[model samples]
Target: MSLSIVDNGRELFVVKLIERGEKIDEHVQREIMNHRSLKHPNIVRFNELRNLERGVDILVATPGRLVDMIERARVSLRMIKYLALDEADRMLDMGFEPQIRRFVEQMEMPPPGARQTMLFSATFPTEIQRLASDFMSNYIFLAVGRVGSSTDLIVQKVEFVQDMDKRNYLMDLLHTQCDNGAHGKCALTLVFVETKRGADALERWLSMNGFPATAIHGDKVQMVS
Candidate 1:
């Protein structure tokens, strides 16, 4: 990573270039999904003067937010005593590492020994662990439960049927469930098709065959940051 310095009086912005991973790895996506599962505190904000006046001790935010707050602070950096990263591994993904590293470099965070630094994650690969070493001293590494068993932990049934038999198979399952009175009238079964066209076709097929079906596709979430 290389940092290019840009200076002005009121606002200072440093742009750093970090290399992105060559291939899109499944592990990184899984880590991000797991990290994003914490929906309770999706956005955390702190009032600047109120927090400082009350002697606020703890704060949590994304790296970008933290860096912005720190840069816009009126006090010195010595006030920041402790820093912790919730999901260190996922934070190192493309378009994120540069900001994270820039914060560590620009923000006058106390030395590794003077200030406490903690890293927590579900899956910290060897490379991420090595990268995290630059921000820690004698950190105690802890690994709990079984590792590399996320997929195995889930019990899923896999069946391959002929492409032409899919519609009939689904209809038979729906008819059997309705006949048995298992789910009242509708079971709310979620069907996932591979492509958007396939989903549209399946939705039409189900509705034409006297079943109320709907297909949903995801849209990009608009985040302020």
Candidate 2:
């Protein structure tokens, strides 16, 4: 998943995984669907959901679609005061820079004090920096510290054991947790495994052991990455 945010002097965006098995097409569809119902004077409306080449499923969009909506036409740049580019780094990394450049070039220019532009990304490389510079005026370069080192939001708990013992150990741990009421109510626990075969084997073992667990990973499908 990718998210974009804007602020007084900076913007932030991030692209990270949700479920490894989720398809790019599905993710794009979900974002477009959610953005379609919004009605706000300050919101930059989503225009369209378009698929890339058949083999590459990421959704690329255009502002023209919003222009096509009679009632929503006011949501276009003629009404908005800012342009926010999300995942600016990944867009350049994945070769969408040219398309984005075209989009920016064609957008309606704002009056002298009318609009602001923001670009955001988790990791901005040299190329992305150059692209952002091209699209933005005087900007501040501010970066928070490295992701995990500063805040440690991701906690890594490790158990050293042989691979063969992992399944049994997992089942026992889960059973104990279940007995303690962790799995009795309506809650979710996610399990991740390295390989498709390993995921399948572990899922079966988990189900057989009476734990309702699901394993989703890269090997599940070509789009899983």
Candidate 3:
């Protein structure tokens, strides 16, 4: 959606606020990759305050960082044409309402009718609705699938394996998938473990067994490529 807006060839300043937590660095790296893949000169590359000084057509930031930049006179919201909040509920759940309100209400951002505001979330609660009411005007509510029901697109399966045999079992599963022609990017798999050490161990085991894999966790510093 953002890419499409950038492709529209209009000079517009857009701001996207995201949730801040243990995964904030990972999220920022992912966003940076997405922006770089576009190779659009108008798309601002995130280099902390340096790129921001030249002005920004699009700014993706966490509420705290954005507020700090604003307080330091590094950026202004007065000319913001579009404002977006990704994972709106998660940000509120993380107790970011104060910062969000500060930037959206207390800052120099244009009023609701003057600027476009969008909030996206997997689930919307009453608090989110109140937030929308306070920050948006004449907005349309869009819902996909049922409110509390899971989508039919995902298939759920459960299996029980002994702890001692778990590695072998996973190997067998991977072998089966490969035999069925799931390779390259299509063969991507995400395995969640309880601890960072466990993730590292699993990654090493997979690499030793000839299955390429990388482990991502909060302890690792993600590099933008």
Candidate 4:
């Protein structure tokens, strides 16, 4: 109890419907057991917190939370041989540049020349890249597929359903996915909306429409106490 949540950054903060968090953790552990490699990518998003402490090859975290762990836990980054920003543009959009710069410039981590650094994004506007300048040296920029392309890892479908048809449309998609056996028991679906209010309303609508949904956004933040 001595450590705040950030100080106890020993586990990944996996977002899940409260009912499903434990199940996802169990599934992750089972998959990890099947791999002989102590350091594999699937666990990168989950066990990365533990692995980083033990000097694993790669680590992953959202910028804000990672900043808390580093600053509060007083974790030194002198041994950080690589620094990779998976969604560089998104981080900037989320207003994490100051925190990121602290990690890159002020922390005990090695400078860009001494470390392998990579910034990945679906789009890298020049202005956003400028925000990342303090952390890179002679870096090579790689762009694959179409500009502003959605991730290859998942299929993104866009629809223009009328306001009244939105619920039915979403239900149809869910039913179609279920019928196709697409989302396994642990498959997570994220619904995005323009505002926190919309997120809350949509979450309730989905629940009423027969889907288990949880709403999480800045506006809905609860005091953890």
Query: Considering every candidate listed, which one attains the maximal TM-score?
Result: 3
* Full-model lDDT for every candidate: 0.56, 0.49, 0.72, 0.59
Which of 1 and 2 is the better model by TM-score?
Answer: 1
- The best candidate by lDDT is 3
Query: Which tens-of-lDDT digit does each residue in 40-92 have in candidate 2?
Result: 11212132222111111122223233233323333223433455566666556
Regions more than 4 Å wrong, model 2: 1-76, 111-113, 147-225
TM-score of each: 0.47, 0.41, 0.60, 0.48
lDDT of 3 at 186: 29
Which runs in model 3 stand beyond 4 Å of their true positions?
6-47, 151-190, 194-197, 203-225
Candidate 4 lDDT over 99-185, as tens digits, reads: 777767786768778766666666878855685576687566666776655667986558788988877887887877667674544
Error of 2 at 149 (Å): 9.8
In model 1, the clashing pairs are none
Off by over 4 Å in 4: 1-57, 146-162, 165-225
TM-score comparison, 1 vs 4, better candidate: 4
Stretch of 10 with least lDDT, candidate 4: 1-10
Clashes of 1: 0
- Clash tally, candidates in order: 0, 0, 0, 0
**Per-residue error (Å), model 3, residue 42:** 4.8
